[model samples]
Target chain A: MLNKVVIILTSILLYKVGGKLSLRSQLLKGILEGCILSIINIQPAYGYELSVKLQQFGLSDVSEGSIYPILLRLQKEKLIIGEMRASESGPKRKYYKLTEKGQEALQLFTHHWTLIKGPVDNIIEQGGKTDGSN
Target chain B: MEATEIIELNNEKRTRLTEHNLKYYEDMLLYIRLNGNKSEQQTEEVLLEMLEHLLQAQEEGKTAEEVFGDDPKAYCKEVVEEIPTEKRKNQASLIMMVILQFLGFFAGSYGILGTALHYFFDIGSALTTFSIGSGLVILGIDLLLLGAFILAILKWIKQSTFSKKEIKSWVEFLQVWAISTAFIGLIVVIHFVMPSFGKEVSIPTYYLAILGVIFYVLSFLMRRKQNF
Candidate 1:
């Protein structure tokens, strides 16, 4: 009986954790385009390479396929341009490079991000303090 | 690369995908391709890029759902929204081509059948009177209904893309049969109910057939020139 109770409780906890991770992904969607632009600003990259880089930078919550729509949007806006280049391992890969417009856009994103990040950080930190004091 | 070249390359690369992944990827392909106003070259280019990404992800043992997300329809919608639309002139030319082709086929078939019945079987008149006003109305109605039918079919196909439940073959057959029957029935009813007005022109069935051939040839030339 005790083992059954522990198993049931553990499953519920795992479910909640899974739900939280999905919620985090939902939140990440808003800033994913900016993140992509910043990465392309660093250096030219392809779709798979961009996803890998994002994962390397601790953005595992963003799905590998999710970056594609953002890439399309960026290309449409003329912020980045994709050119087909030969790859060593396989068929040709479309490498995306940031344009001058993209550079300006990335700088603007950084400014806006800095503005929002500091206040949000302070609020969360102060809210924790108030809870502790209470 | 040209759109045709990209399409050829895509066909070759797609065979490398696992069956499940191919199904997912093809759904996205179809959904994007069905969108008529988008730039064909850009669409094909993006599709090829997507196929490459999927292939790489597959090498790492990741399923399409893992890479593309579970909501394939929503993902496709986002991609479609971002792709550049075709130029207004190109879109107008395409519509004109379709209308011409439709007119050619309808007129050609009707003329041929009427001519055969009149000359070979001694059944009907070789010359028929067509009213300018009613003919235009009928053509307009046919075009509108055909457009609506095509759109509904496309919507149905897109909706089926990530559907969990399998739609039975019989149900699909019945749906297609019903829609086709309704379409034909509506056209026939319109032909009879619409009042004939304006100028009446009497032309031989063979002459009408010749005119249809002319329209068809014009449309074919336009298609070749435009590369649509």
Candidate 2:
């Protein structure tokens, strides 16, 4: 009973503080990278633009700072290619485009996402049935 | 617009944007440097790319906080964590520094011990034992100091992040060069000016001074030309 109370209090404290993301965000990070790659698969983008696109997709917590490193890592892994090209607005911008490897990775992520999503969707849709039966 | 005109326009805009966000950018970069072990080149490239994004955000009328996020440290940590740790360069430099440090300590200890035995204990019969012994002690102190100085520099290098700014500024190089020149000048003045100072203008001293200047200039030029 004490353990349960402690757990409830700790969760309340975490929620009140609110800055820290739940465990879900930690799991979402890897999926976010793959999602970022898929976004790049649509169009080549600079880091900031890519970040804005992520925010547009309802990931308001995503920061521009987080994307550059991920882009660099993807480039290093040969999944994407970045090139410095002259921008009309300012100095040369490093634009990232998906490589063939990145496309393959995106395909793999999509295939895996579907596998997870289909079962989860079914289970979530059956939530009312389960509760009603209970 | 012509290519040159477009380039010039972009340059002007970038310069203006840099002026506005320079301090914010520098603080973030410094945080990265102090927290992580990264090569100077890697740091420079990362900064350059980051600056591009910062400029883009400025163009969009976004606040720095909005663009970089509230927790800059966490963002930097997240980015830095993605970079694969390179053992080769860190290991090589550490090995070289350790070797040099050991040599300094060994030589200093040897000098202190040898001089103590010869002069203080009178183990070796030498005529000018007293004066030579004092000089050896000073030499030993200098060697120990040199070792400590090198170790401090290595520690600073490990902690500090290097960037394009390091390359552009010649202050560090100039400080080293100035010290070298002043030391050589002082030695020459003492040898040539002071009548009682009987230290001859040795061939080895001349060669050493010449070699020091050559290396200094060569390194300065190389650092200027490329990211070292």
Candidate 3:
């Protein structure tokens, strides 16, 4: 009986965690391009390296391969440019760096993020407090 | 580097992937490659980049699923959406190359066979008869049929990439046989129904062979210059 109860609770917990992960990924998708641009702005990085950095910075929910599409979009928009270069461990890799346009875009994204972050944080915190009071 | 060069490099580098990862990666590769109208250079470059990234992830002991997520087909669609289409000039050049090559091969084979029949079997009069109007109509119909067939085949291949069912070789063979029979049947019908109204120009079968050679050579040069 104890084992069955434990199994049931564990399953519920796992389900909730999976649900949160999906939700988190959905939320992250919007801001991911900006995050990528910011990282590239700091230093030029290849696809895998960029993913590692994002994961190291605690954005582990972001799928590592999802960056390629964003990279392609940024390239098409002329915001970033990629150059093929020799890699340390594998075959030649395409290293991406921001163009002037990309830098400007990054700045604009940063500005917009700043504008929304505080308001969003405040609203969420107030909502939490209201729930607590109730 | 040229697109062809990148493709060659990809072929070499992709061997490093594990069997499972290679299969997954190749599905994406074929999906992107089969997407017509995209810039070849960009397509190849992005494919190489993906291969390199996958290799790196493989080194870290991560499965392709972990890196790329489970829904690879969806991810491929996203990638394809961003890839730019080929320039008009490049597309035109490609079309010209195909048409020229087709014309060359058809004329060349007809010339060779006609020349052989004329000389060996003394069938000279039949070999010399040429009708420009019916010839042009037949060429037009052939080109249209060829284009449609190519598009259908490419669409079929693209749709099959993520399909769950196992495609049998016999089914594929039957499809090719059907298309081939249809193509030949249409040509035969056109020859029977269409009137030969154009002035009859009697030319030596050898001359037709020469014209075919010239077209074939032009196509070869264009292909080399374009490096497609």
Candidate 4:
């Protein structure tokens, strides 16, 4: 009985802590923006297609509707430009492409990601080694 | 086969699509308008993107709610908050409003404190006994409150960051301030001019006050109507 009560209490505590850890969402958004810039760095795509591309790359949490805001932000920053074009499928679609600045940003993001990935890999290889003996 | 037939068919298709999704679009627009403070053009752009997304979703045999989730209002609010607009004039006006409101609050408190000191503690000037100093203090308080109200209306008008046209130029703003002060000056002039006018056309102070009150109410209503 006591074991079951402790288990229930610990689960509740973890649930509360999990909900409070949404600060990582900001980190995710920054990384997602860089990923989006890199995707557009390859080819221009509309909002729906860009989101589908993200999903194809294993970003299942990004909804199609949510991508438009990021596109708007990029447009505002002059990092991307969107133009309305008649589509073969349906109505006119706004296709977005990276500007020269966006290309530079994507390159910087790639360079920084490469720099961080090595250190992160090293830490993970060490397998939680926190001892001073090294 | 004919050109007109193709146009009519397209119109029918568009109307049918709109009719099928009218409730969703209306709810989304209303929510964004109420909560996001977006301009008409911005709202229309958002709606166009949503319509395209909805059409694409329908083609895939899914409702917009299924694809984009059920809460479009919250979604639109989140989207609108992310994209910042260039509104230097609005920012300047907002800062001005804040400063003026701060000054107005201080002036009102000072006036009250001055009057209270005179009435309750007899610590103020002897000129207040003749109601000259006290009347000026009261007028100062009224002017500050009215100025704050006008600034509030200006701030509300300039909230549309999408529009380049400012609600008031510096010249127009100064004109409003001058004209309002001149009304109070008119009352002072009337009080002095009453002696020369004799008993025939003497305007009572209360009558002038009533006229001022009517003018203020009418102006407020007119301004609100114009903005909305």
Candidate 1 residue-wise lDDT at B152:
75
For candidate 4, list the clashing residue pairs, or say none: none
lDDT (C-alpha) at residue B181 in model 2? 67
Please give the ranking of all candidate structures by TM-score, highest first, separated by commas.
3, 1, 2, 4
Point out the worst 10-residue segment of candidate 3 chain B by lDDT.
Answer: B122-131
Against the unseen true structure, what C-alpha lDDT does each candidate score?
0.82, 0.59, 0.83, 0.57
> Can you tell me which runs of candidate 4 are displaced by over 4 Å?
A1-21, A118-134, B1-22, B34-40, B86-228
Model 2 chain B weakest 10-residue run by lDDT: B197-206
Candidate 3 collision pairs: none
- List candidate 3 segments past 4 Å from native: A1-27, A88-90, A131-134, B124-126
Task: Report the lDDT of model 1 for residue B130.
Answer: 87
Q: TM-score for every candidate vs. truth?
A: 0.84, 0.58, 0.88, 0.48
Model 3 lDDT at residue A18: 48
Instruction: Give the per-residue lDDT digits (tens) of candidate 4, residues A1-134.
Output: 33334333433422223433243444455567788898888888887778779989998876667676677777777888877677678666678899999888778777766765575566555644633335
Candidate 1: give its CA RMSD in angstroms: 7.7
Chain A TM-score from candidate 2: 0.70
Model 3 per-residue lDDT tens digits across residues B3-102: 9989999999999999999989988999999977999988999898888889888998999999889999988988898898999999999999998998
True contacts kept of each: 0.89, 0.63, 0.79, 0.45
lDDT tens digits by residue: candidate 4, B1-228: 222333343344444444546555555544554432333334445556666667667777766666566667566667667555525554444444444444444444545565566667877642212244444555555556556655554444334322335555776577667755765575465445433321233232333334444544554554344332
Candidate 2 CAPRI classification by DockQ: acceptable
Which candidate, 2 or 4, has the higher TM-score? 2
Give one digit per residue, the lDDT tens place, for model 2 in A9-88.
43442223343545445445556778789898898887777888998999887766777777767877889887768766
lDDT string, candidate 2, B44-148, tens digits: 455666766787788788766777776666677766665555357654554445444444444445444555666678674322222344444444554455555
